[model samples]
Target: MTEKEKMLSGEYYDPGDAELVALRLKARLLTETLNQTSVSDADKRVNIVKSLFGSTGRSIHIESSFNCDYGVNIHVGENFYANFGCVILDVAEVRIGDNCLIAPQVGIYTATHPLDPIKRNSGVEYGKPVTIGHNCWIGGHATINPGVTLGNNVVVASGAVVTKSFGDNVVIGGNPARVIKEIACSDC
Candidate 1:
């Protein structure tokens, strides 16, 4: 399989492969253009964002200083808004569902290295996909680790480190995020 295929399949792959390097460079350039666009130039920003992500639905708004590895591996659904300094290390797929809000400085990482020092030093890495269900809110400075999936209408408190998946309609918080409470939404 190709390096990209391996990467997408969550297998160990060389990140420094020529094709991967080129893709990252292209994404960096696109993100730079996106970050530089004036807030008043909404149309231009929207166009750039459309080109950056693998797929995006309508009414998507991302604040300045957004960065990602391999923008093509990221997908955002309709009415998605990411606040300033949102960074996604999407070595694999990072999918955000409709009507989601990502607060400032939120880090969603799908990339992970081997635990073994010898293997880690060889520069081979793997990634696990991350998914955020619809209408979820990820608070500022929250870190969503590899392979974690947030269920619909979940609220992750500020500065939380989410290490595992959680079901719908819950409020999670703290260093290693735990269910703080259950949200009783009338619509749910």
Candidate 2:
């Protein structure tokens, strides 16, 4: 299989592969153009972001300086808003559901390296998909690690490092995040 194919399949792959490199360059150029555009140019910014992602619903708004590894590996739902400095390292798929609010400096990383020193040194890496369910709010500077799936109505506090999955309607915080409280939503 091709390197991209391997990466998408959650298998080990060489990120330095020429094809992957080209794709990253393409995404970088797009993101750079997006970041450089005037903040008042809403229409232009929207057009660029639409071109970048694999799929995005209407009503999505992302602030300036947004960056991603592979735009085609990212999917976003309706009414999604990401504040400034949101970086998605989408080596694999990064999916965000509707009405999700992401604060500034949030990092969602799907890329991960092997623990084995030899393999890690060989530049072989792998990625797992990250999924955030609907109505979630991720606080500033939070880091969502590889292979995490957050269920609906979840809240992640500032500077939280989310390393595992959690089910619906829970507030999670702190390094190696743990559930702090259950959300009590009247509408839900």
Q: lDDT tens string, model 2, 1-188? A: 99999999999999999999999999999999999999899989999999999999988888998999989999999998999999999999999999999999999999999999999999999999999999999999999999999999999999999999999999999999999999999997
Candidate with the greatest lDDT versus the true structure = 1
**Using alpha carbons, what is the TM-score of model 1?**
0.99
- lDDT for 164 in candidate 2 is 98
Task: List per-prediction Cα lDDT, in the order shown.
Answer: 0.97, 0.96
* Candidate 2 accuracy as TM-score: 0.99
User: Model 1, 1-188: lDDT tens per residue?
Assistant: 99999999999999999999999999999999999999999999999999999999989999999999989999999999999999999999999999999999999999999999999999999999999999999999999999999999999999999999999999999989999999999997
